[model samples]
Target: MKATHNPPTDVQVTPADLLRMAALYLRRHGWTQGTYYASDAPADNPTPPACVVGAIGIACAGHKVEHFADLDTDDRHTYLDAIAVLVDYLDDHYPIHLFDDDGLCIDDHTSPYSWNDDPLCTADKVIAALEGAAKEWDRLHTQGGEQ
Candidate 1:
């Protein structure tokens, strides 16, 4: 589960903060056992509650991770790595969460749709939109290219 793009280079939230928020989200979504107990599991038996896993997936695919360039490269790398691992974990456990009554999809607007009907183009769409916006900004600024 590679990231759709590089994580933001100016994010404000620390890795610790992301972890805490993720845990809180898990608990609020009824993944109490998974939220508090997952860290204790052995390597071969690591398992989060279905809802927790789904929430993680949604976070990975849709969460807003801010970008920050002030941090050292190592710190940014660690943050990116953490997100990658979470995405992989979620990918592996998707089936468990897809229909497990985890309440991850309580609102109709946010559900992950089937591939053919996916409303959230995610990676591709996001990049395209950003690029378009950047080009527009460049044009308006008239830095001597297209004015």
Candidate 2:
């Protein structure tokens, strides 16, 4: 899908905004974190899983599925492209580490935080990630404009 150049109307899209959008997209699809599994299907499949499409939607525009569902297939693909850009940006700047069921760090060799057991950790991470994205967005906007 081609990326859309249309920036969000608010001009102050936050990470939280993206997260909510992504969550909504995932919900529209059949993806649940609990049931998530690696898939070998092509990414551009018309009937892609909701979680995958949702993540792409989040990375592209911070809009809900209701809004996205209104778009044409090409537009949806463009939004997905935008999501790809967002994912690349996040991967470069705020890489998320995966943890095992026991709260042990699995992706990185670092020790797991004792606080990882607390639900607040998840909440805090979400807030912090979104805040960071907002800050980055502000920085980009202030420097020149959206990239």
Candidate 3:
């Protein structure tokens, strides 16, 4: 998916490191649209489910999410730790992350929202968003944009 708005030559848009990481990790692992993980006990999940925001959480966090299910008993703390890390990234211009689709009442920060999205969100759209976001970040940085 291309950028919806391309600014003038003097302007640039820098995406975050997490975007690139999410893309790569999702490509290597797998993506889930509607849930934080594909399964409640995701350790044995063959695909190792990861939604857009979850991907960002797992990618940068030193804590292994393979055992993330076990921490569900303390879900608040689990998410809190992840949120703490996300806060650091938020201090910068992480161009695109998870955004809620007001119309659908679901969170889909990918570009698939630009299209019909009738069949349902797929791994392909997720990957496209990650790669596209990464490219956009690189392009903006090359043009003298700050990360």
Q: Pick the candidate with the highest TM-score.
A: 3
Alpha carbon lDDT of each predicted model:
0.37, 0.45, 0.52
Error of 3 at 92 (Å): 20
Give one digit per residue, the lDDT tens place, for model 2 in 1-147.
348677567564444445455444444543422111215445555433434334545445443343566656865665644444445445565555678899987764211222222333443443344345445555665667655
- TM-scores of all candidate predictions against the true structure: 0.25, 0.32, 0.47
TM-score of 3: 0.47
- Candidate 1 lDDT over residue span 80-114, tens digit each: 54344433333332212243476564432222223
1 against 3, candidate with superior lDDT:
3
How do all the candidates rank in terms of TM-score, highest first?
3, 2, 1
Candidate 1 structure, TM-score to reference: 0.25
**Model 2 CA deviation exceeding 4 Å by range:** 1-32, 35-78, 96-123, 145-147
Off by over 4 Å in 3: 1-15, 40-47, 64-119, 145-147
Clashing pairs in 3: none
Better of 1 and 2 by lDDT: 2
Local distance difference test, candidate 3? 0.52
